[model samples]
Target: MDRLTNPIRPYAWGSTTAIPALLGVEPTGEPQAEMWMGAHPGAPSRVDRGAGEVPLSEVIAADPEGELGAAAVAKFGPALPFLFKILAAGAPLSLQVHPDLARAKEGFEDEERRGVPIDAGHRNYKDPNHKPELICALTHFDGLCGFRPPLEAADLLEGLGVDSLKPYVDLLRAHPVDAALREVLTAVLTADRAEMARTVADAAAAAERLGGPYAPYAGLVHHFPGDPGVIAAMLLNHVRLQPGEAMFLGAGVPHAYLDGLGVEIMANSDNVLRCGLTPKHVDVPELLEVVVFEPGEPAILRPEDEGEEVYETPIDEFRLSRYVLAPGAAPHSLPDTAPQILLCTAGRPRAGELTLAPGESVFVPAGETAVLSGAGTVFRATVVV
Candidate 1:
């Protein structure tokens, strides 16, 4: 087991103090968005081996079989299959969707053939893998996930009574789930700039009058006034998760984190097709192609308690589970068949010889069994065999 030092991403929408508070350190005053703990090549964690420190990516590359195991090397081509993160959102993230593996590979190859630079702002695919992520709330978390029923949307629009929104209300009430969502989203994205601005102003005012579900849209409009994403957000489900609850976002599902902090784990990829609420590239046609337009309730994931709380998903690339060690609890044995990253979110916990405080993490190589003791909470990230 090796203690890992990771980099913190300073995005504008990040909180100035959330991550600092977690690590029990003084604030740096800069926005700390995400603390990534993996070998993602973009910001690989550093591992110390007594003499010196080296990039985790370099260590893995030196001996893939020894570091990642033979099975993982054969399946994932000598690279880590998952990326683990501590995500803190003070404001809101971009409204985005990830493409499936087939689409990701096609997009990546096509961009490479066209000679588009990998760091170009307009480049969509950064890697040729699908990203399916799950976020377990470490604090109160709010987000917009998937789509709500069309009738509920129509009710909100009709209550708003905005002249421009009437057409949307009519469409929502007149069509089925898929068609209504497709047409309403298409209208919002392709609306004329001047007309949409006026509609947004009136809608914001109307949303204030009708508070319940419409209230979130009003808040979104305040953050991004005149942005079409405000209107696009009204079409999705607004979800608020308490600590320990989670939300799993699969490929083709549109989502944006609104507020609070969480422990997020995903397949090691960064192929995002954005819709709005960001200064980054927005490809409308590509986003439409990748979105799943079915409307339903947001799927809230609750872990199954079997010694450890297992957060299950239908993916082979990663598995996230949590363990809460009460005072005087027995030491827990970690899985020895796969490479794992163990993160402590609360209190001090000892994993083998490594003692981790809040926001600290360690990388456990395959074939080594690490027993975790002491009181605190720990989240483990590993691949499913």
Candidate 2:
């Protein structure tokens, strides 16, 4: 096991103090958006060996079979299949969707063939793998995920009584859920800029007048005034998750984190096709192609208790589980087969010879066994071998 030092991404929408408070460090005053703990090439965590520090990526590259286990190396090649992150959102993130593996590979190869620079702002695919993620709330977390049922959205729009939204309402009421959602989203994304701005203003006003479920739309307008994403936000489900609660976002699902902090784990890829609510590139055609327009309730994941609370998902790339150790509790054995990233979120926990405080993490190599004890809450991220 090696203590890991990770970089914090300072995105504009990040909170100034949320990550600092969690790590028990003084605020840097700069926005700290995400603390990435993995061997992803973008920001690989540093592992402190006895003699010196080394990039985890380099370490894995030196001996893929020993570091990543033979099975993982054979299945996913010589790289970590999952990326773990501590995501803090003081403001909203971009409205985005991730492609499936097939689409991702096609987009990445196409862009490469077109001679687009890998670091270009307009480059959509950063990798050739799909990203399916799960975020477990560490604080009160709010987000927009997937699309709500068309009938429900229609009722909300009808209650707003905005003349501009009447067309959407009529479409929703007249068509089936999938067709209604597809058409409404298409219209919102492709609408004329001036006309969309007018519609947003009117919708914001209407949201203010009718203050029940429509209130969040007004808030969205405030955050991104005149942005077409404000109108797009009206189509998705608004989710608020308490601590310990989680949401799984699958491939082709559109989502954006609205506020608060969470422990997020996903496939190690960055192939995002954004639609709106960001200063970054927005490829409307690609986004439309990647997004799943089916309407339904967001799947709020609740961990299953079995000594540890397991947060299950469909993918085999990552498996996240949480352990809460009370004072005087017996030590628990860490998984001995797979490479794991153990993160201490609360209190001080001792694992083998290392002690971890809040926001501290360790990288446990495959074939290693360690016992965890003392009082704290720890989350374990490992591949599902």
Candidate 3:
């Protein structure tokens, strides 16, 4: 097996310290957040194929079906179709949605036919597949996912005592999900500046009065004062996952990665439609068109009690499972399937003879028998047939 070198993605929302600390490097004061370990074209991991730093794409091309397995090649075509990440969000990410597979394919092909550069900053769709993602929390991860039941939103809004927000609270109490969401979001996104500013000020005061851990929500109000997302956040379900917990996001789910480190796996697509809480492109009408507006709680995924420790999500592109190794525990054998990526989230562990520390990961190709011993917890990412 060739020792592969992973790629680090420098994104503005990334934590300056989290990933750098794991890599034993001094912080460059830049936000170095995601360390990608698979062969997704955006930031394909480098493989030392001989003496040069060749992209993993070249290595897989030499023997497409053999190296990546027939199942992967047939599904993804000539390259690794999944992207694996160690994502650390220092601040909240923009509320965004990904288009469905049909839309993604059409958009990508149309852009390509028009001769648009794939890496152009303005490029939205990069591949033909919809991006379905699963984030397994390595720390306490908080996020806004989907829409909250209208009654709960009404209760929160009513308690806040903001007169301008009362219309929205009442709308949620009375109207159906879509109409209520459309009306409320439309009002917030296109409200009169002075009226909305006063309402936000009152809401922040109210959130502070009814405070606990949620008191911090007011700080977010302070951080992006008058930003519509702060108000929009009230309308969505607030979910937090402890370490070892997981959440799945399919196409059209309005969600944001709030904070903390996580091992994330997603279908290789890179399309994103932003709603708010960012300085990046905001295609509000496009986002409004694609979002699933049913008012409900976020679905927290639990692993099925199979003989194997498996954390199953609601997608087909990738499946993430974790094995927490205790001191002196016997070596655990992993699921033998198509190509898999194994990562150590904590402690020191040995995969064959190579010792790995926290954040160190290795790619286990198909048909390989990988034995784990020594120490640390490991999360395995593989494709589900």
The lDDT of each candidate is 0.90, 0.89, 0.78
- Model 2 pairs whose backbones collide: none
lDDT of 2: 0.89
The deviation in Å at residue 176 for candidate 1 is: 2.5
- Rate residue 285 of model 2 by lDDT: 80
- Alpha-carbon deviation at 323 in model 3, angstroms: 1.7
lDDT of 1 by residue, 87-117 (tens): 9999989899999999999999999999999
Candidate 3 residue spans exceeding 4 A from truth = 109-124, 192-198, 213-216, 304-308
Q: Of models 1 and 3, which has the larger TM-score?
A: 1
RMSD of each: 1.2, 1.3, 2.6
Clash pairs, model 3 backbone: none
What is candidate 1's CA lDDT for residue 67?
A: 85
Per-residue accuracy of model 2 over 1-385 as CA lDDT, tens digit each:
9999998999988999999999988998999999999998989999977768889999999998888888878878888899999999998988889999999999999999999999999999988899999999999999999998999888887787778889889898898778888888888889998998898899898888888777656777777777888878888899999999999999889889989999999999988888788767888888888889898899888876856899989998999999999999989998777889999999999878899999999998888887899999999999987
**TM-score, per-candidate, Cα-based:** 0.97, 0.97, 0.90
